[model samples]
Target: MNQNGSEQKHYIDQYLREDRMPHIWCPGCGLGSILHCFLSSLIKSGIDMDKVVVVSGIGCTGRAAGYVKLDSFHTTHGRAIPFATGLKIANPELQVVVFSGDGDLIAIGGNHLIHAARRNIDMTVICVNNFNYGMTGGQLGPTTPLGARTQTSPIGNYERPFSLPYLAAASGAVYVARWTSMHVRRLEQTITEALLKRGFRFIEVIAPCPTTYGRRNRQPTGLDQMRYYRENSIIRHGADPKDVDIDLNGKIIVGKFIDIERPTYSDLLDEVMQRAFGTELPKDDTSKEEATVVGSAPK
Candidate 1:
């Protein structure tokens, strides 16, 4: 609880891992800004850290699980959602959260992502999409824009990237928002709202991977990436999903895209159990006989 009567209010220092003083992210990396917004939101929400379970996959952003001093799980690549789903089902009281990169969430875990969203699981997923895979090296990801220069795409990337926010909204995510590291306050507020929401929520943070993606693409510094965000980014709330599109050299759309209410997975599961099992299954009640072999007589 906070000193004020409000439930949301805490010192950011309370949640940080001081031992890991300096993060390994590059100087221009937008990951730090994302982390800051997350921490601030957690503090503002006044949610108990012990009740919050942060699950992450393998990537620069995935390392966030280790840095946040909470009930964290550093899971395998693209498996964070499954792990979180199990956790949420087992202990519905825990607030399940997922933090991962674009490739981790959309590429390797694409199926799981859609299924989870479709199920309307009660959890929040924070996707830090820096366009490319930064940890392994500068490689094009599902969210990487076309014509972007990466290690694998020396000439230019021709493949189109995924519209993560639009996809999530269309997939039935109850709450969906898109923001960059530049809008720290708004990002934090959006995260706070997502955390408080009931069904599956998706927040895509369009961060910058200056060390790998930036260097390869010639935007070498974090400031350069920030400038790109400032100049080319457009701020609009509740924009129509059909109107949202990102060109190789066009303005970036960032804002709250969707919010809707529906029956969550947990709620639906309980309803099914009640209807199928009639409150609870009887213990040691296997009275029905098993099937015998077609040619052999039952003994």
Candidate 2:
């Protein structure tokens, strides 16, 4: 409850919507920490705040757009990526970030995610993966581990969970990483790196949903899940994404999986436009060609 203190001056409040205090996330939930790391990264990224756009879809994490004091948008379920895509395409100088939940991003927005990666759009996606839908009660989600119990699967989960890092890498993401919310320092570092990287950057954060997934799965508290992460996580940088799936009570592989440069969507489009028109594009558009590509480099 300490406010207006001298030490609190550097408090991570510059990017927050102060009027929106008392966030709606459940107690011990990791969304708050994720948001904190994100804000911290934004501060460290050194990107022009005016050129940064925060986008989110419907979920617990989607509320991030509403709380951040920046150019933010809370879009429809699973559509934050596409919306941010348009923003980037319209203004290539903008640093668009899609911040939302795993269910909204992987389950509902899976198609958009793949296409965006395939196209190598210049954007950062921070997926807060709690293994279930945290906002609308604890229902099973795409990232829920096999054999884990959820409201939709009380006895046990039968479907295999998707390894998001693998999906993003395979989909052609220039940079892909995963970390538990407990790894706040590392998470902040990754986010800052992703923000500065061009092309599709995907960061999957395994956060705790103490009220739902944890209670049903025996953790019962956020600290227990965090402890599980601290003990079980293996930091294997550049690990094979295909072998990084999250299994029930299995070791979690966490690190930067892939980072390779290629032509981004904007880079390709600008080339086409210039050749077709036989004239240089606007000054703002010219800079995009020299940055943020995901495909083969131009000769």
The local distance difference test score of each candidate is 0.85, 0.91
* Shift of residue 297 alpha carbon in model 2, Å: 38
TM-score of each: 0.88, 0.91
Q: Write the per-residue lDDT of candidate 2 for residues 10-128, one digit (tens) a residue.
A: 37777888668668888889999999999899888888999889999999999999999999999999999999999998777789999999989999999999999999999999999
Number of backbone-clashing residue pairs for each candidate, in the order shown: 1, 8
- Which stretches in model 1 have alpha-carbon errors above 4 Å? 1-11, 279-299
Best by lDDT: 2
Best of the candidates, TM-score? 2
Q: Which stretches of candidate 2 lie over 4 Å from their true place?
A: 1-10, 280-299
lDDT of 2 at 287: 52
